[model samples]
Target: MPTRLLLAFALLLASLGVRAAAISYVDEVQPILTQKCVACHTCYDAPCQLNLGSGEGALRGASKQLVYDGTRTEAQATTRLYYDAHGEAAWRRRDFHSVLDAQGGQAALIARMLELGRSNPLPANAKLPEDLDIAITRSNTCPLPGEFAEYASKNPHGGMPFAVTGLTDGEYATLTQWLQQGAPVQEQALTPTAAELSQVEAWERFLNAPGARENLVSRWIYEHLFLAHLYIEGGDQRHFFQMVRSRTPSGQPIDPIATRRPNDDPGTTFYYRLWPIQGVIVHKTHITYPIGSKQLERVRQLFFASDWTVDAVPGYGAQRRANPFETFAAIPAQARYQFMLDNAEYFVRTFIRGPVCRGQIATDVIRDNFWALFQDPAHDLYITNAEYREQATPLLAMPGQFDDIGDLLGLWRNYRDKRNEYEDLRRDTYAAAPLPGWSTIWTGNDNALLSIFRQHDSASVRKGLLGEIPQTIWLLDYPLLERTYYQLVVNFDVFGNVSHQAQTRLYFDLIRNGAEVNFLRLLPAESRQAYLDDWYQDSGKLKMWLDYTHVDHRTPSALYLPGPDAKRSFAGQLLSRYASLDARPDPINRCSNGRCYREGLKAEQRDVEQRLSRLASRPAAGLKVIEQMPEATMVRVEFADGSREVYSLLRNRAHSNVAFMLGEELRYQPGLDTLTLYPEVLSSYPNFLFNLKASEVEDFVGQMQQVSDAKGFEAITQHWGIRRSHPQFWFYFHDLDARIRETQPIEAGVLDMNRYENL
Candidate 1:
């Protein structure tokens, strides 16, 4: 009887152990962490300096916040990520907080923050029955801790997921069960897959190619110098990468924040912020995520462009400046060069597409257009993103004999200031490009700069087509062209890769607030030019602006977004975002627009989807040109092997859609992502490039067939805005280079002699 009893007890103990084992880091705890926690906590500057990336990071704990620090007497803590590491060190929840103690040793802080909001009236003081002296407050968890008594009086459930929802019971149990069983990491973290490794290696090989390295070196120099005041066509007022739309402080109304726009376009914003940190000359290479165990460094020596001997920096009036580029430039020249050559992978990864000819312009189009090869700049014409006139004098007007509000003499007080400094800069730093000089009062009248791209042969037609293909001879420094090229080739992302479904989605961007129509024509031509010059610089703003305005504008009626009332504005339908509910419209209802618009969109969506459905999934082979218009406006196509026949974009689209979308825009069916000129748009291109005699029989059909390699013969069944489907689309660097090389006008030499792909 005793032995049987003992065996029963042993079996029960074993069952509990097995159940605990099931609640592991891999099987249970991590899933909860990944879904509920990691998104907000993973980046370089994790909130409160608390990194929850791994078990070790969570255990290492959260740093003491700057909000509680006695340095400044204000409640305004920085809303953004705290990047300055000196202010905080992560503190372990085990040592300072309650939940870890209750869990025996498992202080998964995430589970703790989450646990607070699970129960409704949050145990008296935002604490569990077990919580003792921990500083997590109950009164306004604006995420700051106060004295003990304050916990009972203020907002109790302020801990985490803040305004967002909390984890489910099963998720909570999995995490707690794992922690109770000693939160050990049950399995190994994933390594890079075979495909990922192969992709990285391919990019590395291309970047290290001799031409790619030299191109990178040149590019780094140009961005560092030129971005500050990249020449706008008319403005003496130079532009810098200044924040146009200021981030609204938390608790502030959203409409106030949305109203402000920047003075100038913020394109080339990344170029201004190249040297993000000062100490490390080699930047930490960031690849497409799952940043594995190994980290790579890029030799940042190429980024050093300025002669640092000069004093009185561009933006800082009286303050002395430190040149972050000094340590790298001080390195032995050979060593510096070798470093760049060795770390080609890092350079390639960071290389992004350039602003000019950004999206889908053909590389050989220049060869087909007015081809000209001008020589490289003799020496570096260093440009900086510095501004002037505003910074020449002190900000506050000083008293000179008389000081009154808006006094003329007081306003003019600082005119005498920095006069000599400005003179020296002009004399020494801004002197002639080939000779010694200082900062000149550049009024965009530097004739030498204009004459750079002005080739003797193409002098008459210089302005006719160019500024399409960027010229470095016109560039103060040409290497920037290469650097931008390499980065873009590696990734080539443009505009979040978001193709808008409706014109309503253009709010914030392209669309200003409450405007009936979003058009560039609304602004003056000069303003339009200014806007275009700096349009793509702020990727973050562009995406956020897109996402925020996307939902509000989805309904056909602009008045549909009924302010911030959660109940009315919220479309409760599952899987439907923003006014997608198919509720019947009531004439008496204040928001009838929502219901009506949703139904209309659904019907339209169905119609387009059905029209698209008529398309055969795969293209019929050997499609032949039966007939085409002599002017090349419309063409008739027929399949040779099969009876499949169709007319699509080549049938009904306008000149703008075909020329810009098909030719310039990168968004096209894989095989068809090449330029075949439309007659209307091709009037500008030199006629000598095309075989005009072969126009009647073989205008678009032959050209499209040749470019598509028989792949795009599949008539696009999908709609462009509604539900566009595409073939295996690729802008593969190697393949693109091959095509460009093959299609190069042999009659004319290369326009950009230093183009990395050609090299």
Candidate 2:
């Protein structure tokens, strides 16, 4: 055909909406983006909200806006040429595909960069496109002397691989070639790695442990244990990201690498990585997060058990081996009165160390420090700092344990013998210390000091209860340290909400032991010391064994999956089935915001409350009467079946300043000195909705105990805030109604269980 005829045919096709050939987006554009852009242009804090992390992010073309708000950032980024041409949102909306066809013009950022070595049209120190008051359309208007000059002058990426030197000829060619060929992301399985083979193998054994199902070492527990940050690279089938320990075993520092995997398998994809998370356990995986297991076989498998056998748990002994609930479970439900009276600080710190994260932070600081390993065996650790020394004295008995100003203060009495600084036998030099207490231990490598600390097996929990908190309790109690403590009791927060706005009804009373702990915590420093000293005066009592009680309350409430975990158990099934996410259907994805989801739960709780309230109809029988005892406050009750029970109460009267416990309802006769704690009979479910507020129990108790009747109950509960929605209300309602019936007995004609129709 003639040239004129060919042109006419192309125009005819254009009229029919047939598009011209363009570079492939996956093949061409993405390569340029992934290499030159994504690193700095991330979500949330990207310079201009131009998220290039994914192909879609790039195509979206800057989901945020530009500002002339005169911020510091605007001033620093001005010298770079990345903002010319495609930098402007309106210019980029024209699309890179058209710019690719145009090849080299001011309209295309990529086109101009590609011309670097080949042809140099942009002049020396050309003005940036965005800098110009007028909109940019093409190249010569902003020419550079050459591509090399362009890199030195403006390419903040230093042209291609933005460095002081700039990209090599071969490297620049590869980028240009990919853009010309079209950027195609090769689709395949995510690659795996053998780097942490021993770790991964341990995980496999743990998952397939002997009796994981019956013992409940299920998928839900694994998700609750650890967290991971990883990703999969596009176009490359073998490139996959995996996590590794932050440092190596040889005391050699190893920066945690974004590791590559060998191959991908469905069973291996998106897993709870067995990376050696940082902590103080030598030859042992120190944290025990899957709460209630007798042996925690799931996580225990990853740890080397030779040094940490059932008989030897390093320092705290096997029975009290580390677990998230190790400290929480050990609390004698009877201790809110018994053992706590012996050592208030010991009891409170032990209680606070219940959570895994807090314990991990505490252990991280003291485990392998100079003092922890080499401190004089019989010497007393001093506290001249006056801040942390006062707070952490309980756990700092060892060398690595004391508060360090990185100076002579944390040093032992024998600093002269080992380090051999003879300047002044007593004095030593110290530098500014690491900020967060967890860091000062020199974690980057296996220093000789850490090795010494590791060998002794001397790690202990850092519950600030017995710990003199250098600052405050903010360090240990989190998730549990929210404002909800005041909210739940005041009944002020929304039904399913977490904030602490006050309302009319309160629902929760604090844990009894927590109440006693807080009472002492609130005392003046000297008074507290005098009180603790007084308790220690009762030598025989202070020496009693730690309560061996064990239990866990946290449960799965939401799905913990990037995609569905096919092996999900009951908790996973419910959460995934009910609370999916934004893009899914109702009942699965469900509810718009957290408040709405909580409201749904609140509604269900209301229904259950109404049903349980009927049980309170009959006159309260088996009600106990509070009787003050010479040794402790006592409550004695006669059952309908002619059995008598007595319970030791920290406070018998309905006082706001006491925490409530199930031990207060134990079966008893007059002669026993012990309360006969039914360790297995758990009164509350320690799930997230409940357990997150563990630290706030005493505060909750004081508010709740102020009123005894329904009016008082409503006032304490913040107008029955949780109603039937929270499981706690069910327990509280039953106990409170029984108390109400006992205190104010109904007439003979009142409701009874027998009055209901028999099926």
Candidate 3:
């Protein structure tokens, strides 16, 4: 064919509404799904197990099995993408049905869903219709190809990107065309740059050095960082890797040893290999950890430079695997503590976001918001005294070491006894030494101070104390910190039976109380009991399990500060001490004495920000709407010039105590609730979105204040809320996503809309 004739033929094909070029799944299709679809379709709890975050996930398609089921009597088979099953045939045998038809005989199920959404676009700027159930607990109707037609006929609005805005015409056309052509996917393999390869080689050599000590250190590091998106400092920011235990050695193809837990035995000689992450980074699962020459040197100083010996490499026995102190006993306790403290935020996030994707059962063990302070390694008994570490090692056994349904009560009782013994030993150890004051708190690094916010089922951790003084403060020492990691991150089983899951949740209750009691011991002796009573006010029988009396109130304070409220005074002092390291003051939320401004704030912007900050005030009894507010709401302030700023309005729900696993509603104390305002989104999931013009800011605030009933709330949302039904939702979402990536590139990822409310 001649060039001119070929061009004429291509033009004819284009004129006939035929795509002359094949769609690039990597460049064209995946990006569309990431922005519009993946938010609700990623992670363990992805609706109907349809994870569109990767090509394999799409090919594997949807399943009716619920990953977040808490009622199962037996452990479910793990179906993790890329790990549990290899290819489409394997997934099909595991009961997954394809959403895309490869033969192209029938319109693919996904194509049909998208068309149904387009044909019956949602009503604009209003609450979603009652028929469209968007609740997190709503039953999933995972229709296969044969059932999709009947499914769509009954529920016209039930489509891909369900209850949200339909895709743009261009996006829809591109996706439909690709599905029409058998949904062919041409995925490009991730190639590491020369620098990245060099770094990987260097790290692998360091981790796999020919020595038992080196092997033990590598095992410890891999267990702690298995979930991390590891990257070498000064390398490409987009490229990230996971440190996996592989049967094949370095330089060979990575044959990952897929175990339920990071510490599970590989059943063969294994090497630590860096596996490049080959999927879109979702905020809920992305945890970034940087390694470089400096980090490597630091590790050497912490583990190798110290005068310590690894008597023998530890086995992956259940008892040793469940106790880090036992497994890594040869490593200096101070070295281990310092390593974790260096990246406290990342470690905290590992347990908070790592184990279970949608974990209300696990998360309900904590208060809605709290400040976390670490005890200095110098003062921490477990770090400084080998005797204390030895005594606490055997007592540190955690639940889920064995996932047996019959052992539920037995495990709980056994753990409870060990916890009691450990508590007594801890109190005696502290009493034997002079009671330290604020000096006991860790101040070696910026990670010394942290703020943890539980946004309902999901949570976030940030360095440096944030927001107003929280209801509870945790003062963690070495043992407490290491146990937290072992119990939650290493031992938690997302696919475990109800018994295993319940035991994990129940055990964390003891950990939370122990940390809280540590903080209470620092307060005035008279005030210690009062604080515990208030924190555990309505706990009926659970108080026995909490064992609040174990707190040593007889110990006198070494330093005295004169104040009516000693707890508040101490927290304020701690906050001021680290204020220099606090994250840059959020322009919207940082207000004092009726003034609000950051270095770059304009006078007009400052005025609006100061006024908006008033919404952060503690809600009075009459502000009934505060009780109804979602966990997180992103408020966008649009200026007349079209420039806008986004802020998060967090509803910090108060509770008598987060003790009871169930009956969370009964524990809610709405009158004591408060709201926190931040300059940008602080949560991975935003429940509602409100867009207001700079001029309408006051009206928006006024209406929010006056809203007392659901009707009034609806009125406010009808006027200002960017409901999923809004035609411009994608525009707002894209803007928010771009802004986050621009401002916090390393930490930013696609915000999840799985919890986006119908209103």
For every candidate in turn, the CA RMSD to the true structure comes to 24.1, 31.3, 3.4
TM-score order, best first, reads 3, 1, 2
**In model 1, which regions exceed 4 Å deviation?**
1-19, 43-48, 67-112, 121-154, 185-321, 324-380, 383-759
lDDT score of residue 576 within candidate 2: 42
* lDDT scores of the candidates, listed in order: 0.26, 0.25, 0.82
lDDT preference between candidates 1 and 2, better one: 1
**Residue range 117-181, candidate 2, lDDT tens digits:** 22332222222233322111111122222333454355332232211122334434444444444
The residue pairs found clashing in candidate 3 are: none
TM agreement with the true structure for every prediction: 0.30, 0.24, 0.95
Give candidate 1's root-mean-square deviation (CA, Å).
24.1
- Could you tell me the lDDT of residue 729 within candidate 1? 13
Superposed model 3: Cα runs more than 4 Å off: 1-19, 102-104, 540-542, 545-549, 584-592, 596-600, 620-622, 640-642
Residue 179, model 1: Cα distance from true site in angstroms: 2.6
Alpha carbon lDDT of residue 324, candidate 3? 75
Instruction: Return the TM-score for candidate 1, rounded to 2 decimals.
Output: 0.30
Candidate 3 lDDT over 168-279, as tens digits, reads 7677767866786679876556789899999899888998888888888888898889989988788887889999888888899998888988888888888898999887
- Compare the candidates by lDDT and give the number of the best one: 3
